[model samples]
Target: MTNFRIWAVGCIASFFLLGVSLAFISMNDQTQTTSGTDDLYEEIISNKAKYEKPAENAVIDKVWKKTPGIEGRAVDVQASYNKMKKDGVFNEKMLVYKRVKPDISLEDLPSSPIYRGHPDKNMVALLINVSWGEEYIPDMVKIFSKYHVKATFFIDGAFASKHKELVQMIEDEGHTIGSHGYLHKDMAQMSENQAEINMEKANEVLYALTNKKVKWLAPPSGSFTMNTVIAADKLGMETILWTVDTIDWKQPTKQVLLQRVLGKVHNGATILMHPTQVTVDSLPELIEQLKKNYRIGSVPTLLSENR
Candidate 1:
């Protein structure tokens, strides 16, 4: 009985010693980790300015009219530190690049024709005006899908009503739909009331189909007057023009289509195109090349103030 009691006591003492040692080791590791974290955060804060950038505000240009603002970036020290803490390691990949907004947004600018996005915004938009080429649209949508790109399609009102399935397909593929007028008439010749009626009629047809109010209008054949602009603005839509014209309606060669767009491409450039054979053939290569340097986006995304 005495021998058993001695052995039991020895085992209990050993267990207590082991527990204390483990607790000390744990405390020491925790202290070291905390110290490392503090050092890391301090380092990041010190070097924050090297990576920080200022935001560019939207401005009204004498020639371009309303221009979009490019979002800037800044290192968020506290947020980054917390992220590192949660991750339990120092990782450059985990650093948070928070967006710095501009003082003047797109909405702050006066209502006018938007010809291009902000020059500082490293992005491009493909503006597809759909009127006649019902056959080529499927292939164009296919190419866009294959490249994982989204484009803005300014659909004609009559076309939208007649080809609801095609419009739905384009919409389903995550493309933005806008207005292209009802009769494809010259807005330059129409009076304010005439233009307003035409636009309203188009909007009605589009709304019935998409169930969403149209926010953009591309006047047919690039014909518009201030009266047209005023009418569109009154109807709560912005008139959009393109920076680059593919001239696909003229049936340029595939190489010509590519060069016409890629050659003159710049930040905030809106490439206007129609549903033509040249576009369908050049879209694949054009998108692949454009993706190498620029972020291809929809019109709404290109014009947005957000990062």
Candidate 2:
């Protein structure tokens, strides 16, 4: 064949191959989009209630005291189906929930010590009592900052008074500050009047530094009587305790501390820890692990009614 004829044949072959490839790509995309779409919306609507959960009301337990209400989950069948359709496949991630507010909220319940948030909420609060391990705080804050998590710190008035700048740095880092009493003394051993005075002094000191009134009080060593709770309520503050106690002051190894947390961790858990070498070593891994299953936030965030 002549040179021009050969060239024409080559051009024809290239165009044919390009057309075939484009047709195959379009067909494959169409197949993926339409695959498993039959009866998808019906399936979602039928199984919607199976996956849905109900709102739990705030309860004042004789032992657990004031427990916050949990916002319920209601499936949005239409939205879930639409999301799946957009993704061109079925995935559990495509599930959508509409929050169902509880009729009786935590505020409606009588005042008492709050130990944990709603058990069904997918969040946990880290309560770091600024005990004697002051040196480890900066490192803890750095880890929290790295993970974009916020925690609540309960500090003693004596420590806050001595290390004003350290306390201020904590508040500046966007962590919530709660009173850990004026002195590290056991408030349960004191009278209502004395406990009130101790709480007031701590509040006054903390307010002087942050210029923001503290609303939560975690009694030192979890030693507080019902009178102490009443005193805190009188001051417009809520008493808080913890669900998971790290007990790092006992000098548990880093592995043991993480194991304790992972073993006992649940929705709305209030993880209590102190600034210690073990905690600072365990914090980064703890936050990363919790983020996979639950959001790490402050006390107010965990107890909030919003989903």
Candidate 3:
């Protein structure tokens, strides 16, 4: 009887030890699997998912909600603070993000196919947004011609219609023409239908006035949505935003404007400024300084992928 009891006690102890060993092995396997899965998730987020441009629905959803990272964080802060300025989620207001790598280079900017052979080594494209009175048109043309430089003008459709001759003058000077929308409406507030309307109307009037297929667009006040992008794409227009904003519209002095432009202008930079008197007054000096310091390149040429 004593021997049988000992055997039974030994067997029970052995089973308990085996059970603990199995449990530990299972837990270790699970821990490894969890670690591997986390690593894979991070790889996807950083490598593949980061470059995918948001779809139309995704853009609107992000605007209403918020994107998941630092980019979204910046947009959220700006949108909340600048509610009166315009919506941040739509249109093509964001031409480039600062955090993105390998930005546009003068070597990369697309040139007019016709001008491909006659490349200007130090020519930069100037883009002026014309949304104000027409009294400055003559002065604009005169100043640009005086510098022997041709700058692109993005005109509001309503303004263009009223000043047909001025719009023609810009085109006649051998400068590029782009659309700035019909009424200067902020794209973030418009419903999808309204966004389409704004885009289509601008395209219509632009073609009517210039007889040129509008190939580019700039949203008023640097606001855009994915819908705005789609609309522009549908109209065969590529959206271009400014890398340098002179904020001449704020009535800054020509010196301040010049400082802003000089500080921000870079390779493949599409600088934005209104065709206000301040900008006109500042251009000659700014152009002279830029020519002396850096190579100026056109937008199309700046966006070339080959470089």
lDDT of 2 by residue, 1-307 (tens): 6999999999999999999999999999888666657568777877788778888888998877898887789998878988887655556668999999889987788778998887778899999997577888889988888899999999998899999988998999999999999869898998888989999999999999999998999999999898898899889899999999998999999889999999999988999999999999899888888899999999999988766
Candidate 3 Cα errors over 4 Å, as ranges = 1-123, 295-298, 304-307
Per-residue CA lDDT of model 3 for 1-307, tens digit only, reads: 9999999999999999999999999999989866755554444334433433321111111121211111111123233223322332222233222232233322232221111111112334577888785787688788778867667788899998889999988888877888889889897677657777897898788889778888878878868876666666666666666657888888899889999988866544567878778877888898788878555444454443222
Q: Considering summed lDDT, which 10 consecutive residues are worst modelled in model 3?
A: 65-74
Please give the clash total of every predicted structure, in order: 0, 0, 16
Rank order (by lDDT, best first): 1, 2, 3
Question: Could you tell me how far off, in angstroms, the CA of residue 166 lies in candidate 2 after the best superposition?
Answer: 1.3
- Flag the better candidate by TM-score, 2 or 3: 2
lDDT of all predictions:
0.89, 0.89, 0.63
Task: Tell me which residue pairs clash in candidate 2.
Answer: none
Between candidates 1 and 2, the TM-score winner = 1
Instruction: Write the number of the candidate with greater lDDT, choosing between 2 and 3.
Output: 2
Q: Estimate each model's TM-score.
A: 0.83, 0.76, 0.58
lDDT (Cα, 0-100) at 102 in candidate 2 = 89
Which has the greatest TM-score?
Answer: 1
> What stretches of model 2 exceed 4 Å from their correct place?
1-52, 73-98
Which scores higher on TM-score, 1 or 3?
Answer: 1
Q: Once model 3 is optimally superposed onto the true structure by TM-score, how far is the C-alpha of residue 15 displaced, in angstroms?
A: 99
The whole-model C-alpha lDDT of candidate 3 against the native structure comes to 0.63
